[model samples]
Target: MTRTATIIGGGVIGGGWAARFLLNGWNVQVFDPDPQAERKINAVLSNARLALPALSDVPMPVEGKLSFHDTIFDAVQGSEYVQESVSERIELKKKVYAQLQQANPGVLIGSSTSGFKASDLQEGSPAPENIIVAHPFNPVYLLPLSEVSGSPRNTTETVERTAQIMRDIGMYPLVIRKEIDAFIGNRFLEAVWREALWMLKDGIATTSEIDEAIRMGFGLRWGQMGLFETYRVAGGEAGMRHFMAQFGPALKWPWTKLMDVPEFNDELVDLVANQSDAQSGAYGIRELERIRDQNLVGFLRALKERNWGAGKVLRDHDAARAAVFHAQTDTAPKAEPLTMAHMQVLPGWIDYNGHMTESRYYFANSETVDAFLRLIGAGMDYVAGGHSYYSAETHIRHLGEAKLGDRLVGTIQIISADEKRFRSFVRIMKGDEVVATVEQLCLHVDMAAGKTVAASPEVWANLKAIAEGHAGLALPEGAGRAVGQKK
Candidate 1:
């Protein structure tokens, strides 16, 4: 059954929530008085469609329906969940919640308030348990963290439900143990923001310089290892304790003006704004958003490759979806090729020629073959058990070029197989056109002995069945072709 979510306030964060839900197959009902809400959301969705799918190894779900409504009642009609991203006024939020609860009393409502605690939002509410903090970072469609903070009134079940909804939408929910203002992420950001303001006032650095200080240095470490872990690594051989002992006395130093407040004045505002404009005003907001999205996709993908931090959440999401895909193929093996993997041509896959690089073509083939290996019960687990298939000889034929932003499908056909060895063919397809082909000979191996070995009976049974199904099919075109040979 398809689920529905209602988004109140179609601004940046709200539009991001809408895209996140809609792309994850939740029908979205939006209620925003702004006449430009649809346009803004569409713009956000356009960026989302380009960026989110690149993070997935399996194909993303078909997008759900999106509808706009004039009234909160009309919007919250059948929505099981509601994400409120209105202006950060306590009264405005309370009014929105009243209207939402009146329409759907039992619906779970998550607020995207950066500072307001769940208790504060819950004040004077009839259904306090239903309202919780689900603050997401900007570009909500890409970043996975959703700080889920709740008040004492919110039961464990409510918190769990909210967290599960976040996970379902490919978000990492860090549930705050206690209700705190600004939650976790924003509180840390608030400190950094204060320091940045002071630096501008003192002429310490320009906006561009502060940004570079982050992106060029610790920001990379913070992205992957986070604050404490990064500091722990800085501790070196003795670890965090030793490092803390060394730096503990520095806390008394007058290095930071975190406790001091800079006067709020027009001069400071112009000083920051003028410098920021000079730094990045060249690109339009949408253009800059696209650039940021592309860079994040690359960084997140690297983390996903290693199954670390936010990448693990992505991998877990893929695994959940892959379970469904694998279940569909659990029946009899088909006579024709099996479609095993779906991929997008990510930004990093292209070369100077603006086409996919040679190595990426091979990476595409590996993705297909790897999925096939998992299907036949010879995946990572089998390798972990000291027996696996190792590619011995391989031939690749590039029939056509694949460029950036193109969607590709990978299909595999079994050519021949036995208990000891098997030969397979893979095609990397762009729609109906074959962009490339890979044929490989593989041998089952005993890792400890480093020698070729016979296949396990269970694995062989699955592989042999697939091979037999493809026995009647003709050989794929260009199969076994040598380099420089005629087509």
Candidate 2:
């Protein structure tokens, strides 16, 4: 059965929520009074379709249906989950909730409100337990954090179910211990925003300078290690306690205006807005959003390569999806080449010629071959058992170009196999076009003994069965061609 999620607004954050849920295989129903909601949400989904899949190694779920509705009742008709991204007015939110409850009293609603507490929004609601805070940062399709805040009225089941739903859509649900206005992330951001505003109001720094301070310095640290860990590393040999004791006195230095509110007059607003425009207003808003999404893809992909921070959430999600994929297809040898891997051409994969770089072609081949190995039970677990397959020689031929955002399928043919060695061919395809081919010979080796060795009985049976299955098929064109050989 296809799951459905109803989105109550269609602004930047709401559109992001729609993309996130839709891309994760949930049919999305949206309700917003704005005439341009569909166009705006489609714009967000376009960026999402490019960036989100780049973060995964396994195939993403087939996207679900998206529909725009005129009324809350229509949108929330059959959706079990509802993400309310409407404006931050309490009465307006309550009004939306009343309508939602009327349509489906049991529907779980997650608010995208950054400031409103769940208790405040739940006031006078017939189904208060069903309403909870699931505030997310901007670019919700990419960023993983979703602060799941609940009040005392909420049951433990409600909170856990909300968190699980967020996780199901590939989000990190940081359940707040206590309800607080703005939750965690926005509160810290508000402090920083206040300080930055003070600096602009006092003419101490331009908006660009403050942003540079962040993206250039601590932002990089916070991206991976976060605050306390970064400070612990900054403590030389002693760690966090020593560092805090040493620098804790600086709290009284009055170097920051965090406690002071900068006057919110038009003068301050104009100062910040004018400077910001001068800094980044060359590009249109959509262009800036695309640039931001691309940069984030590169950054998050690096973290994924290292398996750290938000990247871990991505990896976990991919693993879960891969589990389902493998379960659906048994380990038996197929009559044709096994579809071993699926991938997207990420931003980092492209080069100066606007084609996928040479290294990624090899990476694609490795991904396919690795999946085949895993299927045959000679994967990382086998390596940990002190035996593994090592590639002996490789020949790659590039036939066509693959550019950024191109979806690629990798299929592997087992040419021949024995106890100790096998030859495999991989075809990297974009739709019906074969863009590249990689042929390689691999040797099973005893790692401790540092020599060729026979494969385990189970693994050899699987590999041998696969090789035998391909024995009747004609050899792939250019399978044994040399570097300069003619077609």
> In order, what lDDT does every prediction score?
0.92, 0.92
Error of 2 at 260 (Å): 3.1
In candidate 2, clashing pairs total: 0
lDDT per residue as tens, model 2, 223-298: 9998889999998798988999999999999898777798798998799889999999999998999899888888
Question: Tens digit of lDDT per residue, candidate 1, span 417-438?
Answer: 9998999999999999999999
Displacement of residue 485 (Cα, Å) in model 1 is 9.4
Q: Can you tell me which runs of candidate 1 are displaced by over 4 Å? A: 331-368, 375-377, 381-416, 419-459, 469-487
Query: RMSD (Cα, Å) of candidate 1?
Result: 3.5
